[model samples]
Target chain A: MKILAAVSRSTVARVLNCIQVLVPKPHVAVVSLDEEAALASKAMGVEFIGGPLPEKIYAIDEFKEYDVGIAALDNDSINISVVKALRSIGIPLVISLLNNSANRDLLVKEGADYVIDIDSYVSQNIAASLSMDKWVYVKPLSIVNLTLAVVRLARRSILGVKLGELKSALRSKSIHLMAIDRLGKVISDDSVELNAGDIILLTGIESEVYEASMDVEKLFRRHEETLARSFAESLRASTRPYG
Target chain B: MVFALKSRGKVSLIIYLATEKGVRNVKHIYKSIEDSISVVDTYIVYYGLGAFKQLMDIPAFHSEPPYCRGKAILSGVNLVTSPVIVVINGDTSCFSIDSISNAVAKVLSGETLLHLSKPQTNTDFTNVYRSFLQDILGELGITQSMLYPSYSIIVGLRKFFTTTPYSMWSIEQLAAINLREEALVVENNSCIDSTIDYVKGFEKTFVKDLARKAVEIALQRNTISRNRAEEYLKRIEAA
Candidate 1:
């Protein structure tokens, strides 16, 4: 496949370099005047077009030959323009990296096949890794407008809970406990008990998966509070003298 | 930031941050600017664009990089009704109130329309670069006041900005060249007192980044620096 990457910042170049490293078959070409981007392209061995991106970007002859175009510029406006430009010239697939999430809808409106909310994805991953006891990988099923989240079962709130009990709880909130990945075995049976390190698959309508995740984390916090209160009462009773 | 005495003229402060991921400092910078909002007509600060779009309560223009710097300056100056502006680096550099007010006072007065204050660092590389540039501009018949290193503060009117369109050249060099008669340069204790080192060289692309600025300006102005500037740039490259 002929892939053209519109590079501006070092971050985009770094990502494109990774793609080149892992899958070396595609003929990737990068067009940019940014010195950092140029250096990255040179090191990665992608065909580099070194010059200012002309105002009439669609008029460039080399762009017409590509099957896919990636607009990974730093600016949202430029990225939006590149998406439109690539579509105008009849490229089959156009992917764009969104700098600001505010422009997410705008990229979709203008001919971008896939809009990666790059900034949002990065920050969310960092925050999730820091706050959550067990990591969850979530992806949207665009056709159904549903969300699929694969959550690792590690929190004390649901460590020994039966799969049937957990399913009924999630079902009360319109979520499905799809499957379990426990020790390389797929468990669709709900009678099985939940283990500490089992990976639980969840599917729910658009925003419900996120809500369920938060609800699970909240349960952990609530458990800690009640445990603390009960422990304090026990301590008081133990210290009291027999009257 | 500027103050108009007659009928409460408008003043705008454009804080262009240099480094990235300095979101923590925005609140401190914003609070300080807010205190002066009563005195100065209007001011807006944003860290390298994207981070401040939703973070700050005040009205700010949030943008990503790759903007034409000349057009960016003009667009900012035009936003506020006032043509005067103060350009400062928010992320890496901070200035004393005394020096900031001094720069504003110099611009407000008839003494100079373009006032530039540079940060004083312990290193001598700045001094060396300043002298070398001074001699080069001198040879080109561009008379200037005792020019300092990179500009940390800029207080200038629309005329000064229009005269030297701030293209690829540093604002300090442009201000010195265009506002020669009405320009003032000062060195205040700057980067050393800053939270981090104020300035650093272009690491990966120094040769291209450095050569382009001087060469582009020389070519546009049709100056004699076109032929001889390469020799000086080579020396800079070697160093």
Candidate 2:
């Protein structure tokens, strides 16, 4: 994917580096006023497009190649303006990083797709970690208004139950069981019995996922701390080619 | 440990140093791996002479200007007396004993022609530095062993480096490319991280030029077929 990271701070260099990592085969072009940010992005194989930040995203010829535009300017006003400019240019998706929380509503109104309030995101995240559902990993799938959850079954009643048995519950809740992360080898096979250290990945509408997550905690040794450690071990082992 | 025991003074270690951070990393790496009885000697390959004023006692080579990764490594490889040599990226953040010892063992055991690592702690985060033409380079039958020079900590036979030499911006890639199927991949945390300040300005055209030159070098080495290289050249140009 062609990504235009219109950055204003050197700190965004690490963010750009991360984008390049998470997004597979990303063609990231960073437009930054800061020389440090520009040079750092270039070093990470991201193209440092040198030019004044134009009113419209397409004004820079290289940006026309990019479908997604991210406005990460330091000021909320600039971010709003860049987001508006990007939206005007018909960029498929325009995401703005709101530095201040006060202008969030206005920024959201102006920025069509997303106005990410980093402060709120972090605080809410910290809040979530302290909640009763802390054992379950939940990430909001924004575009669809759905939630993807990884739930560890806390009880032993789920043992000997085939994965197929959960399909009925999943169907009733309208939440799909995406994959079973057992010691990290993500199993899509329903034939596999619900085993210890299995963390089930569920996705559906928010209400349904929450309901499923609560229900999942009642059965099997998909216990919280157990799967978190073992599943992580599996994932680490899988990514390491030598091991 | 057995590898170190069997290969005493039979293996030489060369650390490729480029940035200022690499100078410190080299000293850290030297001190960490100093007691390995398997290593015959340690060589520091820096960018220039001035970079090594404080780095006394260890024999070092200095490469001047327009830093080419291939030239720096091959130059050091040429001077090693050991049958096997391990070329490490000096910018790597602390080499662990486990990683170094395992690689040495693997090479000395004659299990593989070249042993390379996928840096879990690498600065780039991912193997994002995989050859620019990686998507299609496989079709051309050219495989890259060392995707990023920073992750180019490799243990291999000395003859492999002395022969089949191609020095461009991607000498390490070409070396791994030449290894073909004989390269072993080990997961290690020894790679330049984001903390290192190795910032160098480069334009798209310059990068494209480097890729073209890389393709040309591969074509010359018969590692890639002429037709495949031509197709890639066209594709790269269009891109």
Candidate 3:
């Protein structure tokens, strides 16, 4: 889809970089709150136009020259206004960026076909990060309350700890181990041991989910401390130069 | 021992193991589920993480080699029966309960599970720093606040600097694991609730501009007739 994103200069640039990865490279038109951003976006292979809400509406005309009118601006009001204006023009599919919680209903009432909230996106990132067994993925569930995440286990300093022990520790926090993703399948077997780099598909409450995430970190820390102690002891016994 | 259970004939039993966080509320959800469906055999697991930890004390539950892919599946054979597995997530918060309930129900119904939760909001440091910037600009009695960045800029920058790398890493990891079988059930009540706050601001400025831009872009692309574009422009101007 041809996406016209109206954002600040810096955000426009960042969006330009991120969009290529999130979606197919479309005819991206960058509209900024500043004029320089417009020029920069055009130079960066995005259709650039400058101006704030309402006034910036004039720039949308430029995109019509390219046979696409679908646009999503960063500002909720601007996107809604743009969508409303397009609706009157009988345009189809006007999506707005709804940044605040207060405006969601109003935007829907005002005729926003789709509203993308950045805050919600961020929360999803945080959830994703919590789900990570390896390095954290900051935005795990952007779709809100309807996501299943599969995360790989990180290489922990703690080795040989049974899955049963870990589960017990996590159980104290009310976290449940839904299924373990090992090799390439989901294992619900209770007898399975958790190995380093094993992927776990965890399902639970948000806080519990986060708590379960912390348990993995705690296990790693405990393992690392144990390993360090043993390594020191071995070094002392061997009289080897401790690196 | 509080146990929240729900089941449909011929389907898996969906249960939410209650914890102190929302053990009280779990009764309500449990009742609601029971009212909706016929629950089969049920078991009461002790509430709290301590109980779970103790349960794990059993050697059979301990981590071991060869890995147990659920007793029901075996090498070119199947053994254990598919008794409704009451999967419990240790989320005690109300939000967690709701999310877990939704996920479990979906799984039991043979639906794909998707993780659902509220979207994270940006902490408005702009408003905080806005006052500081406004104070600096106040010396000249020029309260225009142009020196201050917009909330979008602040949010965009924060996301770019802090969240981008993490998101990229996650996407990469998800790709590597490639486990696409199980369905993820998610709840978006918080998302829907939060959007109400920004509606007015959106209606006043952002929506207005967005409407105008839609027309402009349509006109620019020649996707719509000039007359239609002009009409759109007029409608927004009128609004």
Instruction: Highest lDDT: give the candidate number.
Output: 2
Q: Which candidate has the top score in DockQ?
A: 1
Those runs of model 2 whose alpha carbons end farther than 4 Å from true positions after fitting are A1-243, B2-9, B48-50, B120-131, B140-149, B186-192, B195-199, B203-210, B217-224, B237-239
CA shift of B31, model 1, Å:
7.6
In angstroms, how far off is A16's CA in candidate 3? 2.8
- Whole-model lDDT, model 2: 0.62
Which whole-number lDDT from 0 to 100 does residue A84 have in model 2?
62
lDDT of the candidates, in the order given = 0.58, 0.62, 0.42
- TM-score per candidate, chains pooled: 0.49, 0.43, 0.31
The A-chain TM-scores of all the candidates are 0.63, 0.52, 0.48
lDDT of 1 at B19: 46
DockQ of 1: 0.07
Worst 10 residues of 2 chain B by lDDT: B121-130
1 or 2, greater by TM-score: 1
Going through the candidates in the order shown, the clash numbers are 0, 5, 84
